[model samples]
Target: MALQHFAGRHDGNRPLVAADTVDDLLPDLVALRRDLHAHPELAFEEKRTAGIVAAALRLLGLEVHEGLAGTGVVGTLRHGDSARTVGLRADMDALPIAEQSRLGHASRYAGVHHGCGHDGHTAMLLGAARQLARTRRFDGTVHFIFQPAEEGRGGARVMVEQGLFERFPCDAVYALHNWPDLPLGHAQTRPGAIMAAADRFDIVLRGHGGHAAQPHRTPDVLLAASQLVVQLNTIVSRRIDPGESAVLSVTRVAGGSSHNVLPAEATLTGTVRSFDAGAQDLIEAALRDAAAGVALAHGVEADVTYHRYYPATVNSEAEAQLALEAAAAAGLQASVAPRPAFTSEDFAFLLRERPGAYLWLGQGGERALHHPCYDFNDDALPHGVRWFCAVAERALPMDASSPTARR
Candidate 1:
């Protein structure tokens, strides 16, 4: 079973029937996913989920490492002596949304649910690990990364900061998310930025408060905040290149407590999304300047806090091609994504350190992500597992001519 002897003998490109790949195991996976969905946990609070993941990986005979980034788990499987390794990641966090679905597996915990399909992601990866362990068809090592807190808490970023790759040291990494927008059983991704860089900015306008009838005696913080909001909307359109894509949305505004009196302070909070670093920088700068200018015009002070969170999720050209090939091998309809999504993913941080690709698995559901009625399509579980296994096999094939490192 030495890896060196297994060289030049990989069957990753051989297509496998998605249904047959996990025929007997499908029910177990669906049950596991449903169990996870029923007891969804929030970001960085996945102790129960991590335990399940660890126990499952241990049963599969993989080396399991726990407690990275709080509730993160990494399972390593090696077949041979090849230095080359590949990593497959899945987020294990739920959103703070109430369950609206009446499914039997609906969230048992109030005000918490797996509206993002992470429950499905976790079960699928576990299925892949089980199959990969049983089959042992590939050389090198495969790291099954169960990351927590991907929902704005930056768990992936924290994992990288804590040296995830330094310990596991993958040649390339890959991640996937179920997309309701695409048809079921389809895999879509593209080289370049697949998801936008997400940044949050908060602005507090402070001014003198007075009765509404004497508005002339006080600086209108509400007016200033409103003007800044309007200005932020124009940054992507007028400030940046027309060819580049960017978005700045004012999602929250808080001001006056009473109708007859002007508030002394107004707070504005929103998000910015962009694909390029230049665009991110441009938007951040624009936000600060716009806030300051409006505050000065209104004779008030603007305290601006622009915090850059996640980088754009960019895929290496070679790895993207490999993912597409792997998807095809898994018998899923694979295609290049026509456009990058505005939503941000913490997986962007992993791509920054290693060459990798992020893909969208089609669930073919009408409900959008984060929707109350959203549910992970159990039918897509086998497809995801097959795709992950194929990607690991292809990325770390027995041959020495694996894809070159991109990061």
Candidate 2:
């Protein structure tokens, strides 16, 4: 059916896409989503998934560009004569997690799973691409970005470094993730800091090794590591401002091999998350200082290595408003997110390069994200597709003189 048939309808002040259009595409999209879920890939190893995405976009006759950032794909659709453009993105990588669900479509890969709903995200964006390509209801251009390695490998960063915006040149970009916490059909976002920055730290304490029962023979590296964990935990509570939010967790500790032997070295590894740059800087510095102090007191040398992975995901004011408007136009309940999530997103890289917003589409389920049993809620697919299509059409509307009326 032509999307123009229901383009005249409006719910309050927001223009609505016809429900039948998305409904017609839902079954095929669901099947595609499940297929992706069963055959999950990780990080840059998304060859199979990328091929599927490219073929689908080609089937729609989009200008497809592949081999970007190793396994990324960009599908360009242009209509009318306007120069305005918008980007809609979806991540295509899965996690190194084993599937625990007994569902028929559970991951066939033993050690990889779509525990984070990227499969759903990809399917939704593909659905939007198909719908938009079919209707050509908007002016200017829409770039469908199928990114890889979002699960800690930094596909977005690589894409940017390799000239993502330089090639596509979107005036604005938008992406959405299926949020299991919020009820289905609801959406939320904020003007800034939708997700926290992720940083990882590894520390090793070196000293003398000796028998466990020996006195004054060893520097007690394990004991120093334990103390260091306590000190690191206090960095957020005491060093960072109480008004701000930050998390410093010591997730791993390793040292001695034998029960009666004191190891010469102990290692500590963990992650830090924060929204503010000031907080991130202060925490890193304070952590280094605390590690040094502990090591000196224990008569050991401290070695520290820290890596900043992903920056905090911040949404632009105008684009954020556009996302909420698009959500409402899609007939979904929308609101400003009460607080930013502590989890980090690589989409932050894209937002840093362009004006855009990252949105959370609620998909209530029994399990939270990253859980072994977690699966993308197929019921939420139509909501995501509608929002994506609405955002594109709203961002690049056709002028009255154009053959197609504004949807």
Candidate 3:
């Protein structure tokens, strides 16, 4: 089947040789994606999803491994005797959202939905794996990493901490996420800081409790907590440099339940996003300082705990260029992102271990990610599969200038 013969809503110019097999595999790919979307699982509880992935890879005759980080799966395929290896990763977990859309493939399990497009991501990589396994066009090996928990649970970090790279070594790695805002068949990435680092803070303000009628007898913690929330917004605008990007949002706040008595303690929690170490440090410090300053002025004690979950996803220059080239070869419009996204990804952990790039594949929808009405656009399946295949072939070529090619 020719690449140009595959007719769909996203059909464009003829793609490269890597996409020749996609025409015959589109039905199976779409079916698999819909099935996965119907049965959504959250975080580390992807037992059924992981099992399906493992079974599919085994059917492809690739060496499969499971049970790393609870439900992570890795599939290895080798062709020629080249030691060069590349890793292609796809997240396999869903989000905690109720199905609001009436599509046939909408989530059957209430409050569990594939709203973030991981279903499509997994299917695209699987399509590429099947094609690459059948054709054996590349000289080196490819590792298909199906990670389980990408929705704030840090499943990629778990895989890395469990010796993922040491077990199956790779010279380079890559991942793609669906972007609903960009037009279909368009891809975008950059060489540095593709996503921001995510950090969360928990603050506690303690004061003496007293009857509401006699407010002057007790320090008011609720007042201090409210002031702290207002102060946190200043960390990004006033404290940090005007040129740098950062965000501090107060997501949750808790206080007393009694109407007659002032609360003795109040709790505040929120997240911090930054692209550089300087901004991250400044944000953390500012949070602690603001909490202490407010609590002290109110004659109360403040306790703050800051946790850094995922670091910034900074792509290497060489891998970013290679990915753009692969996108061009796959007949997709590609460009560099103007600024890093505030959303954070656990794949940053994998990039830290090995050089790689994470690009956004355009799916083109009005609904944003994590929205109840959002669904993975099926028309972009061929584009994602072909891009992954082309990137693998470009990274691990059959015969470059040397016997082994280093990505």
lDDT agreement with native, every candidate = 0.88, 0.90, 0.89
lDDT of prediction 2:
0.90
Q: Cα-based RMSD of the predictions, in order?
A: 5.4, 5.2, 5.0
Task: Note the residue pairs that clash in candidate 2.
Answer: none
lDDT over C-alpha atoms for residue 73 of model 1: 98
RMSD of 3: 5.0
Worst 10 residues of 1 by lDDT: 1-10
In candidate 3, what are the lDDT values of residues 1-407, reduced to their tens digit?
A: 12222222221212234447787888878888999999999999999889888888777777899999999999998878888899999999999999799999999999999999999999899888877776666888899999999999999999999999998898999999999878999999999999999999999999978898888999999999999989988889999999999989999999999889899999999999899998899889888899889988999999999999999999999999888888988899999988889999999999999999999999998989999989999999999998898889888897777433444
Better of 1 and 3 by TM-score: 3
Clashes within 3 Å, all models in order: 2, 0, 0
lDDT of 3 at 97: 94
Q: Write the number of the candidate with greater lDDT, choosing between 2 and 3.
A: 2
- 317-391: candidate 1 lDDT, tens digit per residue: 999999999999999999999999999999999999999999999999799999999999989998999999888
